[model samples]
Structures are given as structure tokens and as C-alpha cells.
Target: MIRTATPADVPVIHTLIRELAAYEKASEEARADEKQLREALFGERPAAFAHLAVDDESGEPVGFALWFLNFSTWRGVHGIYLEDLYVRPEARGGGHGRALLTELARICVERGYERLEWSVLNWNRPAIGFYESLGARPQDEWTVYRLTDGALAALGSGR
Candidate 1:
């Protein structure tokens, strides 16, 4: 079952973040603490929303998809930017990933979103293929850039 997540699911979400980090070879950078997640996700004015996939018989969570709304100047409408989508190793190839994406598409359609977008590492062929199979073409013409803690500090604190 895939449904909207609640505060009670924070711990499981936290664990999944770590697992995804490990899988992506960025475990060292996955430093989000439980308190930070709870506050950012469930406190006054939630910063984001998540949907979880649970096992049918045991009712245990198997995966999740987290997303937030973003406005596109080109499209002139709000869209859903998927931040994360993960399914447990033991649950992979069982269609959980596809199921999660389908649910998100439903929400996007129902909400009249202009587009849905996300990125996958070039070397992660499995994920790349999975997304492509869903008719997502790589925007190779465009590039992705990042700003880190050092960059943020330098930008804010001019000495």
C-alpha cells in the first residue's frame, strides 16, 4: 500500500535516507538527524511531504517517495519536484519504484502540476533505465550545479 506519510513514520524515513545514502556512496553526507527531519517535515508549516509503500501482509514499510512543490517560470504552473524515491533491497524488482512514481503522477495530475522532474547519477544505470522506461529523457543538454556549506558561508559572510 502506498499512501501519504505522517509524523509517526519519521524514524522509518530516517533509516531509508541512510540506506539510500549508502547505496549512492554518500553515506558520509547523509547527516540529517531525527530531530531535524521531524522539525522540517512535521513542525509548524511542513517543509515537504512524503508517501510510503508498506508491505501488504506485515504492514511494514518497504519504501518511500518525498517531494515538494516548485514553480516553473517557463511552464507557468506549480510542479512536483521529487526529492527522493527508495525501496528496500529486499523489495526491489517487485514494482515498488514504479508504483511510487505512478502515485506521484496521480497527485501531480490531480493538482494540475506542469511537470515532474528528478536526477539520477549517470553511472546508476539501473535507475537511469528505470526512469527512462517511464518516458523520462535525460536532459543532457543541461547541467546540474551545486553549492556547498563553504560556498553558502562565503556567499553570506563577506570578509
Candidate 2:
């Protein structure tokens, strides 16, 4: 079962985030604590949204999808930008990941959004294959770039 995340699920979400970080071989980058996550997800004005995929038998959250809305100037509609989608290793192959993605797609269709999009690591063959199987074609013409940490701060300083 998939449901929208509530404040009570912050800890589980945080733990799952760490687990996903470890799986991606970037454990050190998973720095946000539950408090930060709670504020981000359930704050007075939320910056993002999350959904949880729960185990049918145990009724425990096994996976999650974190996303936020993005406005496309060309489409003139808000689309969901999925930031992360993960399922515990032990809980994978049970359709939890697909369920989470399906829920996101459903939200887009119901709201008349033009797209539901996410990025996958180029080296992750399994994930690439899975996305391809779902008819998610890669936007090879565009390159993703970001300035974070010092570069971000420096640029924002208007120097």
C-alpha cells in the first residue's frame, strides 16, 4: 500500500534515506536528520512532498518517493520532479518501487501535469533497464548541471 507521508513517518523516512545513501555508495552525503526532514516535509509551507510504500503484511513502510513541483515555462504547467525513489534491499522485487512511481504518475495525470520526471545514475544498469521498461526515455540532449556548497554560496553572494 502507498500513502502520503505524515509527520509520524519522519524517522522511518530518515532511516530509509540513509539506507538508500549507503546503497548508492554515498553514505556520507546523507546528512539530513529527522528534525530537518520533518520541517521540510511538514512545515507550514512545505518545499517538498513525500509518499511511502508500506508492506502489506507488516504494515511498515518499505520504500519512499520524495518529490516537489516544478514549473515548465514551455508547458506552462507544474510537473513533479521526483528527487528520490528507493526501496530497502530486503524489500525490493516486491513492487514497492513501482507502486511509489505509479502513485506519482497518477497524481500527475489527475492534476493535468505534463510530466513526471527523475534522474537515474548512468552506471545503475538495473535502474536504467527498469525505467526503460516503463517507457521512460532518457533526455539525452540535455545535460544536468548544479553548483552546490561553496560554489552555490559564492554565486549567491553576488560577488
Candidate 3:
């Protein structure tokens, strides 16, 4: 069963995030804590949104999709940029990932948005295949870039 996440789901969401980092072989990079998630998701001004996939019987969370909105100047519309999507390893084949993505796509269509996008690591063939099966095509012409840590700090501080 898929449902919108509540503030009560923050702990489980944080755990899932760490689990996802570990699965991606970069556990050390998962630095977010429950407090940050609470503020970001449910604070006075929310910055992001999440949806949870729960066990139909137990109502325990199995997966989640965390996303935020980005405006495309060319399209003159807002689109969802999914930051993370994960289903517990034990629940992998049960269609939770697809459900999560489907919900996001539904949101895009309902809101008249032009895109729902996310990135998958180049080495994750299984995820790539799953996305392809869902009719999502890669933007191969584009290369992603990031400025983080020292580079981000230097640029922000004009050092």
C-alpha cells in the first residue's frame, strides 16, 4: 500500500536512507539525521515531500520516494526532481519501487508538469533496467556535475 508520509515516519525514513547509502557502497555519505528530515519535511516551511510504501498487513514502511520541485524556464512549469527512491532489499520484487514512481508520475500529470526525473548510478544495471521497463529514457546527452565540500565552500565564500 502506498500513502503519503507523515511526521511520524521520519525515523523509518532516516533508516531507509542509511540503508540505501550502504547498498550504494557509500554509507559514509549518508549524513542526514532525523532532526534534519523533520525540519525539511514538516517544518514551518517545508522544502520537500515524501511518500511511503507500507506492508499491506503490518503497515510497516517498505520504501519511500523523497522529492522536491524544480522550475524549468523553457517549459514554464514545475517538475518533480526525485532525490531518492528505495525499497527494502527483502521487499524488492513486490513492485514498491514502481508504485512509488507511478505515484510521482501521477502527481506530474495531475499538476500538468512536463517532467518527473531522477538519476541512477551508472553501475546499477538492475535499477536502470527497471526504469527502462517503466518507459523512462535516460538523458544521455547530458552530463551531471556537482560542486561540493571544499569547492562549494570556496565558491560561496569567495576565498
For residues 78-111, could you state the per-residue lDDT of candidate 3 as single tens digits? 9999999999989999989999999999999999
The predicted structure with the larger TM-score, 1 or 2, is 2
Q: Write the per-residue lDDT of candidate 2 for residues 1-159, one digit (tens) a residue.
A: 999999999999999999889989999989999989999999988999999999999999999999999999999999999999999879888999889999999999999999999999888898899889889999999999999889999999986
Give candidate 3's root-mean-square deviation (CA, Å). 0.7
TM-score, predicted candidate 3 vs. hidden true structure: 0.98
RMSD of each: 1.0, 0.9, 0.7
Could you give me the TM-score of model 1 versus the true structure? 0.96
lDDT of 1 by residue, 1-159 (tens): 898898999999999999999999999999999898888789898888899998888899999998888999988999888899999999999888999999989988998997888888888999998898999888889999987899978987983
User: lDDT for every model?
Assistant: 0.90, 0.94, 0.96
TM-score of each: 0.96, 0.97, 0.98
In candidate 1, which residue ranges exceed 4 Å CA deviation? none
Candidate 1 collision pairs:
none
Ordered by lDDT, highest first, the candidates read: 3, 2, 1
Task: State candidate 2's TM-score.
Answer: 0.97
Looking at candidate 1, the ten consecutive residues that score lowest on lDDT are: 150-159
